[model samples]
Target: MTDARHIEAQIYERLNKVIDPELGRSITDLGMIAAINAVGATSQGDGDVPSYDVTVHVELTVEGCPLSQTITNQINGAIVSYPDAKLTPHIEVSSMSHDKLADLVAGLKAERKQNPFNKPGVKTRIFAIASGKGGVGKSSVSANLAATFAALGYDTAAIDADIYGFSLPKLFGVHTQPTNLNGMLMPVTAWGVKLISIGMFAGADRAILWRGPRLQRSLEQFLSDVWWGDPDVLLLDLAPGTGDMAISVAQALPNAELVVVTTPQPSASDVAVRSGLVALQVPMKVRGVVENMSWYEHKGERLEIFGAGGGRRVSDQLTETLGYDVPLLAQLPLDPDLREVGESGRPAVLNEDGALRSDVLGRTFRELAEGLLRSE
Candidate 1:
């Protein structure tokens, strides 16, 4: 016969294993376990072999939370781990309303203000991938860089801030929208990277024609609404040029490092330098320049079809204007295989080894990722 103390200890041990899947924290720590009662068996059961009814009261963070069912299952499973336990475990799930959620947000804001970046002691590195023009492979680079970071075992999230031009979804092949839990949006994982994009909310045929203020509001919603859960790195894929979205991102993530992308042509570099200048206007620091479509290999020769010296010119201009050293991070050559893989909804960084179309581009991405880590 199990003693009362033994049963209580068993209950505590089991409950310790019950983790809130969304928050990735034990229920006990989150204050979700309101009560734990071990009811004695009735007269219908034998007294020698006691039947225990464990009741756990759970408090959810948000009303209409989709993860409530999952939490209930976990709680029930935790209570049934005892071998001699015969009674069914009762689980109750309740939620806090909108007012409580607002209070929670206010508390978080206070905490953030106390320790910006919420690192408390550690630093949170933010990277912003920007370009002067669209279709310049900026999204692809952002996705692959994020994938590489995750592959190297870093907690990373890639945010598609390009509300109108969201291509990260198709590149990563993430089809499902994030599940909402306790008023928090959980990011979907792909290629080991957590991702959120406006594409998940807006359909393909629907046009995103919002002006500046509306765009800023949406961006803020994306940042605060989603539960990023303290990632080590947050990569932002900004829309091309110095638009409203870009300004909003600069203002919101003031500590973000700038990585400008451009082609090898002088005209492309000229525009790229202008974009870097715009970032400077926000008083944001420019990290370096990345030259995409630097060249293409045909047969045995390197063909500079887009013209050369664009990356160098942009880097030089940034260094001169910022009065700081701005190096050329990487020169990503043209790779048809990369384009095909991206079109097929598979980023080259996650593809099988040696299966990548352009080994040069792959190496460049890996090197860039290494540089990021080294800088940190």
Candidate 2:
């Protein structure tokens, strides 16, 4: 006969494997496994097996978590692994109180501070996508690149670090604010990518005319206040131009690699080169260049709408100026359908054969994601 205590221990061990999908921590460690009561059969009936009724109380961060079903299933599956247990586990799901959740968030923040990735020990591949000017598709590229990486099964997030010009929420079609659980802010998920942006907090068209100090404070809060769960890749959509916000981003993520975006025109490249130089002020590496609107495909011929070689020119200048090889990561052509998809609040990568179909640019984004992962 199996000892009841032994079975209980085994059950606890199994529960450790059941992690909170969002938090990336086991329910046992997170204090989400509120209670585990095992009621054993007092006596065995003739030709009948004994049974144990186990009740597991789970505390969810949000009142209406989309992952509640998944958590329940995981808990039930884990409880049944004990031999001769005759498993009948009753799972109770409840939300943590605001105060208690606040404490949890505090603890998580402390843990992140101590985490190697957050520290200088572990390397987190941070990419800042900056352009010389707005409407150059920097935000769109950041959003799509993040989605592509997440689709490839990497833990990824795109921070709308452009505090004043936040647009990630619209691009990813996420309208909800991050839920606070035990003080930790759970990032909104869409297209398998976790996202945090000021757009979620402020209205899309609402103007935020904050000063430099307030902007810096907001940026710090975005990084420290939110629970990012130690992502494998973090893509930052930096506001265009070299300003205080860009400087703050560089300071916040010291190891961030830069990918300057520009059109094919020489003037665009010239302006983009200045932004790349600003990245150098923080001494961040200029990874490569992404040239948007390089050309438009008319029939089978590629028409150079924005002129050409701007991406190459920027890459060449960065390599020469920085004393390192800065290659052109990709040249994204002008796809009207891609712009339409963005306007419709859906990423082109997820739609099959859509405007942003699986073409060279798409492949390049995937490759860029893979390369970053490998570098990390």
Q: Which candidate is the best by TM-score?
A: 2
Per-model C-alpha RMSD: 5.2, 3.1
Quickly count the clashes in candidate 2.
5
Q: Tens digits of per-residue lDDT for model 2 on 83-167? A: 6658688998898877767777778777777323346665457888999888888988898888888877778877888877788
Candidate 1 regions exceeding 4 Å error are 1-21, 31-122, 202-204, 298-301, 352-359
The prediction achieving the highest lDDT against the true structure is 2
Give the alpha-carbon lDDT of every model: 0.77, 0.80
Residues forming the 10-long window of minimal summed lDDT in candidate 2: 114-123
Q: Which ten-residue region of model 1 has the weakest summed lDDT?
A: 111-120
After aligning candidate 2 to the native by TM-score, how far in Å is the CA of 18 from where it should be?
Answer: 1.1
How far off is residue 329 in model 1, in Å?
A: 0.5
For candidate 1, the per-residue lDDT at 70 reads 81
Which residue pairs show backbone clashes in model 2? 101-182, 101-183, 105-182, 105-183, 105-184
